[model samples]
Target: MTVGQRSGPPIPLLGVEEEFLVVDTDRGEVVPEAATVVGRARPALGTRVGGEITKLQVETRTDPCQGVDDLHGQLVEGRAAVQAAALSAGLRVIASGSPVLGRAVPPPITEGPRQDRGTATFRGLHDELAICAVHVHVEQPDRDRAVLIGNHLRQHLPALLALTANSPYWPERDTGYASWRSVTWGRWPVAGPPPFLTSARKYDEHVDMLLDAGALVDQGTIFWDLRLSTNHPTLEVRVADVPLTAAESAALAALVRALVVVAGDAVDGGDEGPELVPELLRLAYWRAARDGMGGHGVDVTTGRLLPAAALAERLVALARPALDEAGDGERVEAWLGWLAADGDGATRQRAAAALRGRLTDVVDEIVAQTAPNVPMSEESTLA
Candidate 1:
């Protein structure tokens, strides 16, 4: 995988990891029943279903997929498996970025010795984390190239934020922001964009400093919007909130893998992009979180505000070549059209709240939307 000897075309194989909130139907709030929900689904979901740091949350991990269709189908099945399991437990799973209610309470953290130690060390910050996100992992050529991909990803981070903004309601109420999860996540000292580093050695050195300074617990806590994965040979993007629909999830996955290919090409060609200040990147992310696709976003190119929808289209254009290479261009375009018509989760949730005059209705709507299609005949196989 030498940079100079690169031949053929770039193929950034990728996969999706989605987290969901388990809610008590009677209470209309997230509940600490992930263990039950996950256990019941274990035989069906196998390794795909697991517990998150909190008992209110469960996550699904798909196998590394070489094509967008396989990745998309895996996500659909993962959601359905969890949805069916939750329903059997007299509950349901919602894909909102955070809890739907403004006055939602945090459930007890999941029972694990490691989680216990983290709670003891971080104190209240651990309690503040009831958020969930959609993480995408794209194959990398090598560790050094992975580090460069992180650098390449910074400019588009805000656009990523805008496309998948889902958390508008948090602990207090409609926070006037789209992705409250992003704001909540930023409270962590090391949880935003990665710093500028040219090589894997330098990136490792920076992470070591964060560990020594106690800014992070370990490599797992790097929490950068994008980073070289610790456990996999993929560069992972952790910036997006959990999108509600299969269309939205697949769109993000397609865009991310294409962007990785775009970056790999740039690195091989010896092209260097501008070094943006971390503060500016933070401001861009904040703007996207505040507006979703309902308003303006800070343009990463000129530091000026642009309509979020327009910027999102531009982002898709930038990655079109890579999307075409992966045979995902038509699908991504269809997703964009659907988003233009129906809006994102944040928009839909707010609309539901407004129409029914209660967040409870919003929760019900999310539940109904996430319902798995039962087999028409008992023998029908799922996708």
Candidate 2:
């Protein structure tokens, strides 16, 4: 197929997908109650939030938003609806990438055709693949631009991962790794930063190969860190774990919007960015998987070693222009400050668990973070 240049208004928009674990508030154990919550929230579905692969997972997508303020409102409203539904079902939602309950025997498949197929495919790959993630999708002008943006964005994946790391404990065990969700996702054949694509045509060719090999059903099945959306004119970043709070999730989405604007502009202007070798990108991804924000450092372009803090500083500097250009600099900076000070949700949850000697406290923290009006002390009753 002949590839054409992307065509549309250059306005960048943002959408978010957050997955949460359903747990009994008192027991702090996983419950197959997501359906109940989702059912209760049906009147708000599509208008606010939606369901995901398992009975324990739910996802929220913001209405296409042009700025951080709109994004924030959508997130707050969506999460409120989900939390209310969960409360009505006598369940509390846990937002960590991997729940504290660990991997239980695969629950019976949820009711959708796509989810059923996804479950079957996942079961074929690993025995324990019950982790959750937050996928951020940013609209591009068209498919070609989406492909180009995905390619240029690959080098920065590690930086974004470091900032969003939230899954420290996995399977009820303290995994020293920062984001155990990365480890779980790595089990998939095509689940990391994608190899470079020279052009949109080449990307299509690669997708065709995967389909021919029976590795994927279609373009939607290509689960790379960056991929052209099969249904929308957007590039989706699927690297980060599900955040523990709606604020964190919104912050990540804002950053993604800024990154996409920068990359899309570079491609649109025919100024393909500084060539970042694939090997370096791969190594950087490994560093993100292993140390998260706590890791030493990453050379996004050269793949050389550096301290994680230093790398974060560099990324903030690099992204400042983009954030400013997109008029979201203030919000992005605020979010970064929160990440640096409190550490990511995973780090905070692990520390709280260690200090209190109970997973219930961690769950309570998540609940408090998710519901803005609910006081922390009241939320702690769950603990």
- Per-structure clash totals for the candidates: 0, 4
Residue 362 lDDT in model 2?
Answer: 76
Winning model by lDDT: 1
Report the Cα lDDT for candidate 1.
0.81
TM-score for each predicted model, relative to the true structure: 0.93, 0.90
**Candidate 2 lDDT score at position 206:** 85
Compared to the true structure, candidate 2 yields what TM-score?
A: 0.90
- Which pairs of residues have clashing backbones in candidate 2? 102-171, 296-307, 296-308, 297-306
If candidate 2 were superposed on the true structure by all CA atoms, what would the RMSD be? 4.1
Q: Which candidate is the best by TM-score?
A: 1
CA RMSD per model (angstroms): 4.2, 4.1
Error of 1 at 40 (Å): 0.7
